[model samples]
Target chain A: MGIAREHDLHKRRFSRNRGVGLALAAFVAIIFGLTVVKVSNMDVVGSYAAGSLTAGGDK
Target chain B: MSDTSARTTPPPAIGGEGDFADYFALLKPRVMSLVVFTALVGLLVAPVPAHPMIALAAILFIAIGGGAAGALNMWWDADIDAMMQRTKARPIPAGRVAPGEALAIGVALSGMSVVMLGLAANWVAAGLLAFTIFFYAVVYTMWLKRRTPQNIVIGGAAGAFPPMIGWAVATGGVSPESLLMFLIVFVWTPPHFWALALFVRSDYEHAGVPMLTVTHGRRATRAHILAYTLLLAPVTIGAGLTSVGGPVYLMVAVALNLWLIWGALNIRRRSEETATADGYRAEKAFFRFSIFYLFLHFGALLAEAALRPYGLGGW
Candidate 1:
């Protein structure tokens, strides 16, 4: 019977587990987005490299 | 057999059944909102700009860091929270979340937020965020909160750091303007909190939190609010002279400070007996206005930044 899938404990904890799962997923997405931005040199390092020549440019 | 056992026996513990909302409550979302709004204004008003993704992530990390510090504070102040009517319904006090669990979450989130902020922004912002967490959790929560009447005065620095950190996120370091923003919030804190202390004096009394009202009497607390409000006026208006401040900010600052000082005067003039008769109407109104005062001040800063490109924002 696979230990009864409709356990009360699972029912009670479903929301918590879902919340944590969503949070972790969001964390991963943020990291991925940050990684993409950093690698594309769209962040601080990129601006520093571009210097005054690129200042007041696409911001 | 399992069904039979489940039907026959009750759950062993009801207190640990907290769901996601309870966990979120530990983060103090209301406080986080203030942190977010102030930090956003600080970031926007800076001369430099941040990438959209970086800016959004930096704010997110700062908010998370602020929330983590709140959780840590809740964990440490669980006992006091349990006694105070205003805080007794919090997650830890209500027994929805375990104290240890709250502490763990706080520590973990604090670490994650700092590291992530460093990656998304700059180390200067990250370092400032770390110091802010330490200031709130260790300095304010552990050392000062229960110790002195001036707790909120000094502890206010923790709340004041977010704007500075946001400015650093864009500029990669602190500047005069950022420090001006910090000073504005720093001075604004005592009056704002003291107003709440006036109405909810009993909460601090019962919690043994050593609030000004509990130690120095309501009359003294009222005077303190007015004193701080008087001191805050110049700092608030002085920001108008800075690069970040503009005509719009100055107008907003002048109007708000006038109203704030007027409100504080009303609070100071009232006797406890009169306040009780009026249900602390002036104090409560002052408290509510203080919130709007801060929001509009920051909003004016944002308006200046937004209008700067149009040649109408700054002095």
Candidate 2:
């Protein structure tokens, strides 16, 4: 019984961790995309601040 | 159960029935959330700008680093945590996660966060994050916590570094504005934590951690709270005078400091007998308010940042 329980626990833990590395991979891809955006001179901060302020219109 | 069957089978998992949530708890999500928010504010309010995705990546790495510190802290303090009622049910102490697993996760994530932050941002930010993890895991948890009442006082620097790291990620260096944010949190920590110690005195006593209330009496601890809060008011106000601040931050700081100082004074005036009679209500209220004190201060910085394009922010 103890052995069976141990097997089940390990099974569950493994199942839970399944694709965790993939999730991390996605995060890495997103970070890579960010690096590309930064290197390419995508001025998201300045543009967004300008757009938002324009939209707000003196508020 | 034959000996052959037992020998053929594997042993029970050292921490039985542990689940995904238990591992998440090991990350100390609450602490991570606070670290993420402060780092984001630091990045946003910097004079230098970053791409949104880059900023997001930096915050993510910083949060992971904070969680790594928390996991390592839990691993080291498992024994003490088990003794304290407040932490007796943490993943390690509750037997939901093995200490070895926590340590593995901590060390692995520490390297991952620091290296990733370097890739996502700058080496300076990455170095700060690495030092933050080391300070929390080693200096605070392994060394100071069990030895002295000043553990949180010095260890608070670990928490205060996130904003500076964020600023470094944006500007590639620390500045007066970033230092001001760091100073506000650093000074705020003792008063904030000491208030908690006042109410949760027995937990630290039972855990044998030498909190101020443990080393000195409640009266001295209360005195310390008042003294620190008084000292904190200036740093809190000084932050408003920096590039991060404007009318919004200044107004918020002044109002909050008045209330915080009042709370500390109230606690100072109340005797231990009085606090006991009322269930330490004043200290509890102060503790609750202190959380808002930090959030609003940072929120005001965000507000100031937002208002900057309109020429309504900064000195």
Candidate 3:
């Protein structure tokens, strides 16, 4: 009975740690994804601004 | 039984004394890349032209300011980072660099970037750089992040300021065009960030951070992502209609926004089990596409600038 109880406790602890590991992986992925999106969008914003400004100047 | 034991055991520690790469990591290279690219766009799109040397100086200063913000953010978030697995390997948390050292580097770079920009460009650009550093370090990292679910919503403003700073470097003041650029980024940030938040709620929960997922639940977070993307679509299209963007940008915005909206809508429609079964694969795919979306958009602006002399580009 004592050995069985010890094994159960170890299993619970293992599961808890696994949860943490998965959570960490998700967080890293999110940050990376966010960074890439922002960096990539820079040109769209810039060109749009330039086109409008030039058009306004001509008018 | 063998698999169970392997799963139950902790991975071996990869921690050790750091090297140059660790210091570079402390600067947050990915964030710096965004800052550099946006600032370059701001410089290029501005109505006033700058000498090449001055333009180079402005970009370098903006980059240094971005690095300063990263160092300080790492210093302040060291505790939470140590707790969170994703950040556990970071320079300060991983024991590669001391917190005090990071603090000093942050402070030194902040002053250097601001002063150099003021000299090479103008005081306005310098002032904006100083504000960007303070906003990221104090407002975003220290206060907003832990305090609210809207953390990224507001903290994202700091990231959006770089292009405006670049515009100021060229034009010596803020203009309507620069403000529009800032607005587009500001609106885009929430949807961009919340997509990731949907899948990473557990990490924020473990760190005791009140991200949208932790505060509002995954369903509400998904709804918010859709709402923000809807808002982002018009702003992106409007920006393409502006002076900085031309026909090329308009076409790109239309296509990317359509795809982005599709991704957001799919996330909204999917069941939690279905989303989770693939680890929110649709949302993850959207997040991946989001990165390319922004890169292509910005790269198009550079292309527009190159074509301007040939009468092939104009607002």
Query: Using Cα atoms with residue i matched to residue i, what is each candidate's TM-score against the true structure?
Result: 0.91, 0.88, 0.79
Off by over 4 Å in 2: A1-15, A18-22, A38-59, B1-13
DockQ, ranked from best to worst: 1, 2, 3
True contacts kept of 3: 0.00
Give a tens-digit lDDT track for model 1, residues A1-59.
Answer: 96876775566589789999999999899889888988888566767876855765756
Candidate 1 Cα misplacement greater than 4 A, ranges: A1-11, A42-59, B1-15
Candidate 3 chain B lDDT trough over 10 residues, lowest sum: B11-20
Under CAPRI classification, how is model 1 graded? medium
Native contacts present in each candidate (fraction): 0.65, 0.54, 0.00
Query: B2-74, model 3: which lDDT tens digit per residue?
Result: 6988898976434333555666677899999999998999898787888666787679789989999999999
| Full ranking by TM-score | 1, 2, 3
Off by over 4 Å in 3: A1-59, B1-17
Worst 10 residues of 1 chain B by lDDT: B10-19
The better-scoring model by lDDT among 2 and 3 is: 2
Candidate 3, what DockQ?
0.02
In CAPRI terms, where does candidate 3 land? incorrect
Query: What TM-score applies to chain A of candidate 2?
Result: 0.48
Docking quality (DockQ) for each candidate: 0.51, 0.31, 0.02
